[model samples]
Target: MAILKHFAVKNADYGAVIDYLKYQHDEFHLVPILDENGNSMLRDEFYFDGLNCNPEAFDLECELLNQQYHKNQRYDEIKCHHYIISHDPMDVADHGLTGEQAQAIGMEYAKANFPGHQALVCTHTDGSNNSGNIHTHIIINSLRKEDIASQLYTERAIDCKAGYKHHLTKEYLRHLQGSLMDICQREGLYQVDLLSPAAEKITQQEYHAQRRGQLNLDMANMEIMAEGIAPMKTKFETNKEKIRNAINDIAERAKSFEEFQRLLKAEYGIQVKDHRGRFSYLPSDRQKFISARKLGSHYDREYLLQLFEENALAAEQNQAQWVQDDPITILFIKSDLRLVVDLQNCIKAQQSRAYAQKVKISNLQQMAKTVAYIQEHGYDTQEKLQDTTDTIQSKMAKARSDAKLTEAKLKRVNEQIHYLGQYLSTKSVYADFLKSTNKKDSRQNHADEIAKYEEALQFLKQHSPDGKLPTMNDLRSEKELLVQQKSAQYETYQYFRDYHRELQTVCENVNHILDISQPKQQEQKRLHQSEHSL
Candidate 1:
């Protein structure tokens, strides 16, 4: 019941598409213009051929389109020779109207919506023996020529240019969609609107897919966009290794799609749908999301296919993949893991700051109690009182200062944690990364680095005397040694990552190879089995 609208222009070479349809469906009568229930200038016609490719049907469609567009414009310079609008044919059959009746409704709708445009409507029906779907096509010519009244018997012919352009623009397309939606509602048909994709995360395929159902497209290949250029190509293997290492980076926290979707929607008015119920994913809400051919009723299949071919070629050149691999998918997994690790670190960092603040506050409170006790009992121990007071005052001043510093540090850390948490909430890359990394364990190599960092922190903390800070020199030397150790592990991680990327690339290619190979292998296995049985 969904309807889609697409616009296209046919050059002189294209002639008319209805004429082609006339030959395809050879059963129905093609009606003429003069006989229809409207006062239109063009000849009304119907299917001389059955439903799809009949001359009469083509002529009838043109006649209807002319009635809406040209009307009484006897001198319209540009005539729309062909326009095609097709829908699920079964909807028409349900109306219990013959093919002619369905064609009539389309013509009527065209006249009502595009008055003053030359309109032609064709209805194609798949018989009960076949699919039983009935669809209508409408072609409209958008230009008309103005006439000048000649004083005499037209001694000279007036040169008239077309007033309207041949093709529809964005505004016009929206108008088309609105009219179609209105028609669908009136006719009690099913309809769905598309969602656009995110701007920050723009990808070419995502952009193209959005346009597929809503616009007339030319074929463009995605390969061209996929091709890795100079710097990226030079370090392709190296960066690939980094990416793999990042992907395999230890996972500290994970959330299911349902949990994430709930959080995203509740926290940030976004809707996610897991196509096939795989996992909640934000659906693209853009014109490009729907393939022009997939746009309910108005999708032009041949035109869209041409667009896809062009897209495929462009994609191939850009990325230059030997086999098809979903790059967004790969990148998404890596990003998701990055977010998870960051989020976990954020929570831990927050706790550490909170603990530091609490310790500072408790220490300040205890120091304040000692000062109060000394002030209250000063007369009883006068001899030692002066020295004790001096010591307590120094300790109290330091405690107060430390407390203020701790509170300030905690406040800053809290702010950072809040901001990072917000960022992690919206970021899907982390979730994807979590899913991918969880699939394989690359934790053993990084484990030592993690242990060493923890050990350095512990050693620094343990060696520092109570209430004393470690010297900058000591901190610097400790950090330098840790960095040196981490660097070695980083190299190992890079090697493993590069090795993993190669494996993944091979695995991705294997899918395509197996698609063909599996059947042949099966065939050979069947032969072997038959031989053994014999």
Candidate 2:
């Protein structure tokens, strides 16, 4: 049985969120600590954050908090948190917990999950009828206020790297499901996926169809056509305009329709047809003369039409082949991939800083230990050692600060990677599905579908994938650069490891004062050398 499933956080004003929730459900009940007249004589702490606080007692406290903060300005600036710990109520009922009991269990789960986290927890009964699941809201003041030196709402130094305790990522939520599933086993609730799947499951066509309606396939074909045609760009409007301009240019010289048709067939190789028998515009002899003069040979009408249609279909077919190649490839090609670039850059920058910090910190620890040894154990070469120690300590402090900054960057990069992975995963699945399937439709419908997909692909090419457009070659080159960067990082890590170990050994020897060591100085020298190598 799986237990945990989906988790999300939204930043919003507390009051607005509460109001929305209140309005969204009529039967939704809110119990407060205070009476209707706003008096709080009752203070109960049976359950923290809504779990097992006696329902009667929970209601009282809720009322009290509401009365206490309804008019407070702080409520307007906080975010309301909500989550669900779902188990099949029917399954639980079979095990001994009734529907109300299951709802209570979920409420308790929510409450126990985030105690002392400055949050409000509540359970719902009619969750399934409302939204196919039972859940709880952990409404907390995004901005917390406490009398102690450390308060919940105070903005602490956020190492976004470390994430939050009560709040977590989609991945964390899935992990949390494990705990919930255990609870279900203990309480005899039906178990299911603890966290929702980390990736999206949408197919490419489905995803495109979400935004494009019925035209996704056409738009896709158009993109393929554009890819196939080397010299011509892949803009439908541009292509249409070019064709129209050619038509108008030929029309400008024609004194009659016959001459106009002859000019088109000979000069542009276009064959426009009305409901007449296959016929050429000019007299047979005159057309032959024009063909020799303009086209330098016998230009045939049927041959020109065939050539044009073949050219058009060839372009279209190549794009179709592109879509058919591999859905993941298309997804990789079509994503808003600028984030990937930005994240890669950020990670590289952070890794470099962390590497430098590791080296400097090791050197500083060495210097600190040596200085202490000189002061306590011996003073034969004290002054020089002290000077070196101070310098190392300073450098180490700077390194530690830099490392913190790097860690922050790495954390952000990781988060961005998670986001991009989800987006790309969903798109790839759908693209693959679209490429693998075929459908039957009227010829006109099929053509329209093709056109729609072409238009959508064009729009995606222009905008959705992020920043400026990149050529296929550019994508390959960028990947190559990332590979090189990774290699450089690996080298840095190697240097840090060897130097840090030597420094630690030197520092330990100095503490014992056993060998009257020159190792401390030697290690410091090595540290400097390593820095240069990086």
Best by lDDT: 2
User: Cα deviation of 483 in candidate 2 (Å)?
Assistant: 36
Q: Rate the local accuracy (lDDT) of all candidates.
A: 0.41, 0.43
Prediction 2 global C-alpha lDDT: 0.43
1-534, model 1: which lDDT tens digit per residue? 545444444332223454434333222222323325543232123342222223444445444444655542454344453444445555554544456755665776665545444445656665312456556667655443233333222223331223443444455456666666677667665544412211123233433344442232222223434564222122122221222222122111112334334433432223334444222222212222222222221122333234445555676565545223423212322211000112233555467877656655654454444344335434244445444334434544554555455455445434433433443343344344445555334334344444444454454445444434343433343344344444554544454454344333333333333455589999999999999999
C-alpha RMSD between model 1 and the true structure: 31.2
Candidate 2 on 20-98: residue-level lDDT in tens? 2333332223233345776433221112233323332433443344445452233343233455454455653466544
Q: After superposition, how far is residue 98 of candidate 2 from its true place, in Å?
A: 3.3
For candidate 1, the per-residue lDDT at 320 reads 49
lDDT of 1 at 254: 10
